[model samples]
Target chain A: MSEEKRIKVLLAKLGVEVHWRGVITVAGMLRDAGMEVVYIGNAFPPEIIETAIQEGVDVIGVSTLGGNHLTLGGELLELAKQKGVKDSMVFVIGGVFPPYDIPKLKDVGFDGIFGPGATQEEIVGFIKDAVSKKLGK
Target chain B: MSEEKTTKQILQEAEEKRKAERVPLYNPEALKQIKEKFDQWYNTKLREEDRKNWFVTPQTILGSEIPRGLLYTPLDVADLDYMQDIGFSGDEPYTRGIHPNMYRGRLFTVRQLAGFGGPEDTNERIKFLLAHGATGINIVFDLPTIQMYDSDDPMARGQVGWCGVAMDTVKDWEILFDGIPIDKISVSLVTHYPTNTAILFAMYLVMAERRGIPWDKLIGTVQNDIIMEEVVRSGAEYLPPKWVFKNQCDNIEFIRKNVPRWNFITYNGYNLREAGTSGVTEMAVAFTNAIDTLKELTGRGHDVDWICERLAFFWDPSMDFFEEVCRLRAARRLWYKIMKHQFNAKSPRSMWMRCHVQTSGISLTREEPLNNIVRAAYEALAAVLGGAQSMHVDSYDEAYSVPTEAAALVSVRTQQIIQAETGVTEVVDPLGGSFYVEWLTNEIEGRILDEIDEMQRLGGIVKVIETGWIHKKIADYAYKEQRKIEEGIIKIAGLNYFRAADVKLPEIDVFRYPEGVEERQRKKLQKIREERDNKEVQARLDELTRAARRGEPIIEYCIECARAMCTEGEMFKALKEAWGTWRPPAYW
Candidate 1:
């Protein structure tokens, strides 16, 4: 009956993404909700997954506003699967995403899709609920 | 002749008259009596419970949180002196407006920011807008070009032409302006940072030069700013702050002497304000940056008047209509003072606070996306009343994606309606004499000056960026504002409130970005690499390397490299090898 996990999460911007105010705001929001959030500046997709594995985080949030979601985002999830942590971790994507891209992102193995206007409370609640059920709390 | 006094006596009389014009607007005794009467009116007529401690503000940014008064009077602006503080528009210390007739003299230039996909695609859009009556041109490059990566580089994968135009070589510039008039209209290149400006702006120059346009007749602006890279723009490789500042001054030096009609730099306060800084902080940081830049140029033995006249500013006109109007008036006055007292600038043009403004994209909401149209209209109106030399109204769909042609046309219509039908611009600074506007103008001016003083005390803009002090300030501001929005302390119209509306986004189409842009750009770069004279490119790169190492100006070498069809990435690598690279400090 112990549901006291800190809900560790890792966040990073895709390469050369300049509109990172969204990532900073989300990282702060998660940290405010008592989540252990590790934020690394813009990195390559493989390096980001490697850091997530090394840090043993429960979620990977990749933010990119540069309209590269189809290719780069697909590669991000493919790397997660190749590294054998695809099922263990909940992958999420955020930032300037069109609503139509939601289905495609889900197809690429993104467990959650947060675009513009997604509230902080909604995100923190979603991640909390997903992580707790995974922990069997 | 006998009635005329001696020259000494005439000089003393003129000085005395000038001192007389500096008198205060209201006497202390009169103001005190009015204050007592206002309190009496308030206690009897106003309800006690109706008076709340909190205030609703037009903008939630810093310098905007305060108590509001139910009434404003002459007593509120008792300290204002009309002749000394604010005067007629187009006069010295041009607080009211830069031109005496304001819009009667000329309407504000409608510079819509349009770029996304490959160079030819954006070029077609530019021609369409021009045929449709847009007065000015504003070009924003894509993430790869803005970050100084070639279209073929792995770092540029999938992002070549997403955010803006993909420009790799001088050939791309040629394609971009293939049919456009170069000398007739003014172009604003959103080239942020020294290295990017050094590369892309050089391409623009080479393109125009190859077309045989005389350099002296060219008219446009390049955003050769350092703070935009160091503090505002996030997540990219940057040249070190010291070296970045040096290159910015070097651009000013070259442009002032060569392309004399073009504005070399528009110190970017717009990006700062949109990045969660207060309106006052935005002006303060921009003025401070200008002060430091002018100093660097003067140290190189250029007079203040020579290079400072073509310098310009870019500001963000936020939702606080009166506050922003006052900020602009106060900014004009303060800049005049700085140029006069600090730099002893001789030319009046050097003292003019010429600025191009844009509506705040952050202030637009994602919920009920159409609500953004009304919001942007109000912000555009504010920019007009504030006397922005040129302005771009953000489209409603900007909160979601790049604007469709329909959305962009609506933005142009927004500006058109304001300029033609509203009749708002018939008068210059019509709100100049309002008690609240005058009082707030003086108050915001003082606060901006105080911020400038604080920055100067703390080792100026470069040192503060190195230490990440400014970064922490902005982050804290953004975080607090977000918390307010989440707590419902600051309610967005359809988002945090009015939840009953059907917030369906299908009402408008999210712009379908042209497909295969990245592929086309990659192929173009590959062709240029194969076809262009590689030996000539290498010779120019070597000269860039040698010039960068000796700490000599590199813009000349960059121009030569552009002449040889050298790619932006090739020249940037040479400079990076010499001047070094920087990673921003992690303030969070």
Candidate 2:
């Protein structure tokens, strides 16, 4: 990608749990950072997220608040792995989870896990670092 | 004089003839401008992934379940009879409003759903809320207790004391209510199964006995509506339909005989709507379950009036303002009609549709936390105008964890402001005569009736649920609503439209689970296991099992087991062995 080409990211939510506030914050930060952004919206199963990734998004984020976080999150990771985009696209997970559940989240291959108190700068920096690692700029 | 036409006569004739002198369209032309602006702003023509951003299309809309309109007009409700259907405030049906004096002097209960740690932590929250002008308390049991598992059960690991307070036995109850006077305040719990809540209620009675408090002085609600739970949860897959009805009947019979003052069942459509089903679906499913409960109780010789007196409802007020108000009005009118015309209920209370409402939890966005407070305020007002008896506003931070103290306090303050500052309550049924409200109310009622009839043909709400009818409908709507939002059809402020800058909200006071709650609770259960008259516990369990088998009133037997220190899970397991667990069909 050229320096003039801004990284475009799409954030979406899957399942009945509809917590999108974190994704919105990240989207605003990315836009401020001069990156192209799109928010796909809530309650799409893993297939839709895969579609966004397939659409050549630079990064993909998904949020959930319902009880089935374990099942849905794991499915997204497996889908990403199967699609061979697991390493190419950064995957982030956020919403309500106990502190101890973070290790299990890491084990599931989420690139970043933003728990309850994360800020916009922290999330934006993580995305920037991932892009830098890939681009080696 | 020609003839005395009943309300039914008038309504039917009006529907067929459409002969009323036209009132200029009930909603002013401003609504059209709002719609035009909304469409222009939304750009529904585009395709998007966010359900919140997508536009709702005619083809994508659920064939039978969609809410007809966002803003209903007088034409939508032209056929409704004000006197017969709505009636006066506090009168029969109380459709317009429950009381002529609603909110004139008193405010609806300002209860916040709070639980973290163990009994002690919850007790402290309760004390704080009571002192802060919360008229009642709504309990949120941790996942362990909700699933009826004791602290020591393997299924309870990690989940104990997570979401709400954990209770293993009567002693947990003792500590949870340590200094609070139960009889003086209204209490409601978000529990569904009867066996556990019945035993818990019996223990509460025992606590009151020890405190020298009379049972009649107790006022509150126990959410023992098993059918509603089944429909709202994974489609009541655990228990057989026969057993589900039997458990509900047993609990109702027991509550009526033992705890006369408390509401026996708090039926919930709130969970269903929050699950993303339409408002019409919520009303239809709720009423269908209510009818099923009535059939079971009355078939067993319980008087309709007696059962109706204790029956109650729980609803979720979503973000659709006018639609929600009409939904509430429609609920009251429909329930009253069912009681008067169908069940022949003579008592006014039997016909009254008393409800408790919580704002739609799904409406809270995780992105812009502060914006949720505004959404909650609107939902709360909708519930109030719709005549909710009690309400709990969902804390904006619920998407994260148990609300911080500041969030909960602000939630409470939202209600206080509405009660004290806003003159909304000054006039009872303030929105009653509004052409839009009345029309929307009638349309909502009409749609609900049609849906309920459709569900009845499938053998009732339980069968409809057993067949996975409700879940499919909710999933379908959830999908379409998402598509519309993602496609820029409907713009959620924070998500789709006029995106705001990333803003930091004031820090909320977090409530942590009490330390040692699970360990302490497990120890208590262990002590009861060692110290309780073991033989007596066995005896009571045997008796309860036998009573359940014999189709006898099982509440008393369950209470006896509670007295002997039998755990909630053990009692539930015993019944599960007899009735089996319900599981929803996974067509997805």
TM-score of each: 0.95, 0.76
Best by TM-score: 1
lDDT of each: 0.85, 0.70
Off by over 4 Å in 2: A1-95, A98-137, B1-81, B234-237, B500-510
Write down the DockQ of candidate 2.
0.07
Fraction of the reference Cα-Cα interface contacts (below 8 Å) that each candidate reproduces: 0.71, 0.06
Docking class of 1: medium
DockQ by candidate, in order: 0.70, 0.07
| Candidate number achieving the greatest DockQ relative to the actual structure | 1
**TM-score of model 2 (CA atoms):** 0.76
> What does the lDDT read for residue B229 in candidate 1?
77
Docking tier of model 2: it is: incorrect
lDDT of 1 by residue, B1-588 (tens): 345342223324544667756778788898999999987976787777545522345435333553445567998787677877788888877889888899999999999997989999999999988988899989999988888889889899978888899999999999998888889888888998877888888889999999999888789999999888788887557789998889999988988899999999999999887777788889989988998898788888999999887989999987777788888998998888787666778998898899999888987776788888888898889878888899998999887788889899999999999999999989889888999888788788877878887777777789888999888888888888888877877667887777646666655688888989989988998888899889999999999999998988889899999999999889889988987888888888
